[model samples]
Target: MQQLPSNSISLFCFFCMLLSSSYAKPRISSPAFAANSCNFPAIFNFGDSNSDTGGISAALYPINWPYGQTYFHMPAGRFSDGRLIIDFIAESFGLPYLSAYLDSVGTNFSHGANFATGGSTIRVPDRILPTNEGFGFSPFYLDIQLSQFMLFKSRSQMIRQRGGIYASLMPQEEYFSQALYTFDIGQNDFTADLFADMPIEKIYASVPDVINSFAYNVKSIYNSGGRSFWIHNTGPLGCYAFVFLYSPSAPALKDSAGCVKPYNELAQYFNLKLKEAVVQLRKAFPSAAFTYVDVYSIKYSLFKEPEKYGTSSVSHTTYGMEEVRINTTLH
Candidate 1:
């Protein structure tokens, strides 16, 4: 064979190196926490305003006030006073603040993406706004989040160049599955429609459908080779402002300590069923690393001992939105 030019050979080698680097796995950042050692390349957060960075802080919509005031000093689109647990988790991953999936497309997929939204629930029809107007985050489901993650992966060398268009949706036994997927949702369905005075039998009738929908969401990700997952249990709903504001009978339903027991009790039942589902999922997909993130206990602690966690002022609603102050007997 004829000898090739030295410059030509060098160019070919450089091209090959570039190609290899482009197809590498997504990168996760390290957290500053002393104890947390989680290394997630990207965090796919799917849930409500608690973990919402800006899902409710949109400019066009008539959103809530003081929702994220404490943290950003002026509603930086969060539904809390400060950084959420998911935000802290992302930091532990050594990543910058994860953006809402509704944001831009020029972001770096190599760093992972967030798919959380405010007022979002696992149910397809999230819930009716208090106006009885309509559902919020319509057509936005857990599947939408998975689809966005797939898009993020495709834009990166993680799958696009190597596997093909539907690579993320396909099995990845030959590759390292490092993406950290979290599903922290399902509170809206209860608060918006399934609450007491709404007919327990109606809720009972819909429970199976909701469970099946959630299972389908998990299975979709599973089929797409999502091996690492964190499913958050539903937070206590009885203590939330949604029920506190709308229903005057709420305080009457509370147990000692002024915490609503029946509402919390129902939440507990839903959470238990979710936990059981996760257990069955683990058995079905032994290769997957699945863990439950406890939102019930976390929210409970914050509610029961707001002084302990400094979140007593976390309560707010349309009626007493401003009147609601962050006060504690201990505080």
Candidate 2:
């Protein structure tokens, strides 16, 4: 990931980068393969709400209306009013939006399956989910997601070999090795720690373990036939609307973008460590390709200048994309 030591200066550079190009593309870790050269047959995603295509909604209760209304014209399990980044990624590859592995009804896993769920964390939370209480955290943490992927990989092939109508929906065995494995988790780990009333120092101290757990899962996927990895670092937690409402800070404690200063700093620190972990992964698995996308910088830029991105305000909840307008012709 690119370093952004100072929010002000980094944001200025971000603006310049945006102006220089029509689309603000992600920085790729490797340049050996050009975009057109990649012919990804499928995309297997593992992450939290940021990349979740409806795992939580399907596993638990369905996401209520207005969530997928913008793009899907109804509640299509996504937490957004429109499609997510993952949806666009799938479309870019000429593949359909991934079916949630947890969803049983009308699912076709021929292309790929998504193991992501809302509120997922890199580490296990103090309170495991599947409770009678309302939503808090997901039981399908990164490790759990990994387990589901393993099972899906095995069971999918088993069913496909049976040679029935159902088997047609399953992906070809070769897809697993050639697919692009995507990740967009870890934000919830920090948020969960903060909500549990843990001190900032303690949260900072736990960074190593968090990154280690994430690395462990990535390696496991690599072992499970995943070769190409596209990992997204956590976004700007400080700019989240929930943070402003729940963890109010003085004007002096706010950044130029009006986000809580300390929280954004913590996010940047997490991203830095995550980037380092990706570097280590590359060294260990020389045959595999790892692409680290600095989503935090991109999201922060939008929050810093909402008008530039078609959003009138960044005060809306980060989990929802109701404010961000997408052109019908383009989307």
Tens-place lDDT per residue, model 1, 1-331, is 3343554333322332333345331111111111112344555667766566654444224345565555566656565556676777666556667677665433333445566766566776544233344334434556666676667544554554577554443323322255667777776666656433776556646666677778888877778766677677777777666566666678788875466787777777787777778778877877775666565776676667666764454454432111122222223
Worst window of 10 by summed lDDT in candidate 2: 322-331
Highest lDDT: which candidate? 2
> Any idea what lDDT model 1 has?
0.57
Instruction: Flag regions of model 1 displaced more than 4 Å.
Output: 1-37, 56-65, 105-108, 126-138, 155-176, 310-331
Q: How good is model 1 by TM-score?
A: 0.72
Tens digit of lDDT per residue, candidate 2, span 1-331? 4444453332323432343343454454453321223567888999887777878888877888757766798888776777888898787667889999999898999999999998788899755566554336788999999999999999999999998899989999999988889998887788756654578999999999999999999999989878888888888777776664445442457888887788888998999999999999988988888877777777788767777766666434344311122222221
| lDDT, residue 111, candidate 2 | 95
> For model 2, what is the alpha-carbon lDDT of residue 280?
96
Candidate 2 residue 92 C-alpha distance from true site, Å = 0.4
lDDT for every model? 0.57, 0.76
